[model samples]
Target: MKTESMSSIPAGNLAERIRRTGASRVVLQIPDGLKREAVPLVLALRAEGIAVAAIAGDPCYGSCDLALDAVALTGADLLVHIGHAPVDERKGVLFEHLPFDFDPAVVAAAVPLLGGPAVGLVTTVQHAHLLDEVAAVLAAHGIVAEVAPGSGRTPFPGQVLGCSYANARALLAPEILYVGTGVFHPIGVQMATGRRVVALDPYTGDAQEVSADRLLRRRFALIERAREAESFGIILSTRSGQARPALAERLAALSEKAVVITMREVTAAEMINFGCGAYVNTACPRLAYDDQVRFPVPLLAPQEFEILCGVRAWEEYEVDEI
Candidate 1:
């Protein structure tokens, strides 16, 4: 979704960056869509006399799941993670954020859609690098674009992830502007913060005010379907990050028919094999929200499970984040 992702030739010299690490052997972990570029990159590194010890084949959605195990197993000095910003600190991992750039003036597309005097600004990592420039553009229009300092999983100021909308939630404004491609993050921000959200696709300059009403209606239907489920499978991720074992255990305890299942990848077939009428996903909150169409059965978030169990009321509905 970024302007120049690994899908295209990456912006910086990755080999040079790896060489700077002083680590002779390194593991390369790339996202699924970017794997097409892996062979060329590996060959380039090898031709430069750098030993690429391994290329992790695991599905990598974010920096939250580093290939530390691969690095350790292959005796590699470190790992060069591509396409995402770092979610946490790890000694043996290097991140190439590959942030996207767009016309800073693109903030004007969202101006007419913003309902209030001041607005909080949040965006995906791709657009994070241009936040200050975007703010400057908005300032000319007499709009204050508030960007909160990074904290928790989202380390870049004004950056918001599908699984974490903390940056947007931290804003003090009544309305928020989300600069990115998709409606999901903006929808999540709206639900999580209970604030009006305007989403602008920086590349396309398309802007719209996002609403969670449709998503909530769908989730409510899924919850109703889950209430009739004979068994519940609370998914626990075995990845380096995205693991919520304690939360999974707690959700599993809610129902006698519920059990915790550890998985590296949660697939639709796996749910069918589990034979549970419904499943609760603790791994990657996006699995429950974004990938519900791919799943055959109801896949509820942790909070949605609480709602179904009568622990939380419908009015208290909130988006899942880790």
Candidate 2:
């Protein structure tokens, strides 16, 4: 789809860059959305006289989930990771972030929802490139958007991830403007900062105020139901950037009924198989918040588990972040 990035090689120079890597064989990884282009992508490299050893078939949610094992088995010298920005540095892995472009002026739809003269602006990696343009659009509408730099995990200024909202909280503005697709990010920001947030869908020009009230209500009820559980399985992810061993261990230590369980993928089937009545997810924080419906049992976030154990009060509630 005519992508443009130094890391994300356009078809014109795809072969040349692979040759520059000095690798005899390469392993390619693409996110689920771009998997359909796998054949053409491989063909393009082959036409350029590049040796593509493999295309990793597993679901790649982000650069956080690396296919190192695929590279190791295929004896490939380099890994072409697509569709995400680098969350951490790892040798032999090249991050090719695919940025989604849209008319920045579409952010004007949020102007009506913002309260103050200024607001904090943040977005996911796909839309991070348009942050400055989005700010300019807001500024023209008598609304100044503060585009703050994010943590190392999110290198781009004003970018926020599902597990990291440092950029939103860094801004001096009272309210937040999130220019991205999903309500998940804006909802998380609202919960994280307890500040007003308006989510703007850059592509659709749809804007709406974000609230955590509904999510918190559901979680609060789930926490109550979790009390009936005889035991809790604390899930620890093995994904490169998502693994929080210390946090998982600490959560496991909170109660005698809790025990740490290592899992590459926390599926409903696996949870049912583990036989735990409830789970305390320390993996990708989004799993506990976003995909809870897929599981039959209650999956609690680290912060919710704290409230359940009486270590943290409900009044001190906060969203789970890495």
Candidate 3:
């Protein structure tokens, strides 16, 4: 519930955008971590004579998890999705970029640990605005930090998402410096680019070199266990942005035992009900890599499934991205 160092959440652009949309009923949806700002956001919107239909209370992981069902239930004309950029140009949904402030000088703490003269810089959306300052800080230490142009799910240069690391892979830098909260992103960057990665927690001032060896070992074990399965449930996301129908179809064709299963939220219970001996997650890449312990069976990434099916070799191991 603590907002930490952030003083006030800005509503300047939000109100104007809402007015432009001419929406009478709006459903405000925000990520779970920023749900605290919903009340103030609703107040500001209502103050402008915009009727708040309802707040999308479901857990929002990213812009991909648009609260369309909630918007429909409330008969909202517009959905104000906060904290992420648009993954898809879905009608009736507006994405508001939420910026968080942090000192760029924190990059200095990570500079000395960077082993390369030139490094790729990547961060989550919250701190992506500070990339210019971060690059300058790295330059002060004679380190060149290259922030590659963002594409796919990430819309800003140097910005990375848990499900997308296109910005990091674009740079092809020998080493990557990720200024973000968790080790998950940095680890994903390493796997996505096959480069050395260092994660710097801007708030805590903690930096560490990341390795995919541990995750690889764990995935290898899962693949081995999954081989024992009689059937595979190919998880296809029903979310507006996370859905990869074509990829799911391709993966399903790989094995006769595989069948496509669609769900809004991929959970252990759903996987259990499907009664598949194993699952291949084609949804958010994190569900397989990060949430494996929470899964009832081996939840493999698409590439991992290919490996299990003998189409791809273990040496060709790659991280799944939208």
Model-by-model lDDT, in order?
0.88, 0.88, 0.89
| Clashes within 3 Å, all models in order | 0, 0, 0
Error of 1 at 292 (Å): 0.6
TM-score, model 3 to reference: 0.93
Superior by TM-score: candidate 2 or candidate 3: 2
Model 2 residue 93 CA deviation in Å = 1.0
Worst 10 residues of 3 by lDDT: 2-11
Candidate ordering by lDDT (highest first):
3, 1, 2
Which residue pairs collide, candidate 3? Answer: none
Model 1 per-residue lDDT tens digits across residues 1-322? 5343233544247777877888888998998878878877777777777888999988788987887889889999989998898877778788887776788997898888887578899999887889999999998999988999998889999989988988998999999999999899999999989999999999899999999999999999999999999999999998877989999999988889899999888999999998999999998899999999999999999999999998899998989999
lDDT of 3 by residue, 108-188 (tens): 888778987899999988888999999998998999888988687788899888888889889967999999998899999
RMSD of 2: 3.3
Q: Which stretches of candidate 1 lie over 4 Å from their true place?
A: 1-12
- Give the Å error, residue 21, model 1: 2.9
Candidate 2: deviation at residue 244, Å?
A: 1.3
| Reference-based lDDT, residue 321, model 3 | 86
Q: Indicate the residue-level lDDT of 14 in model 1.
A: 76
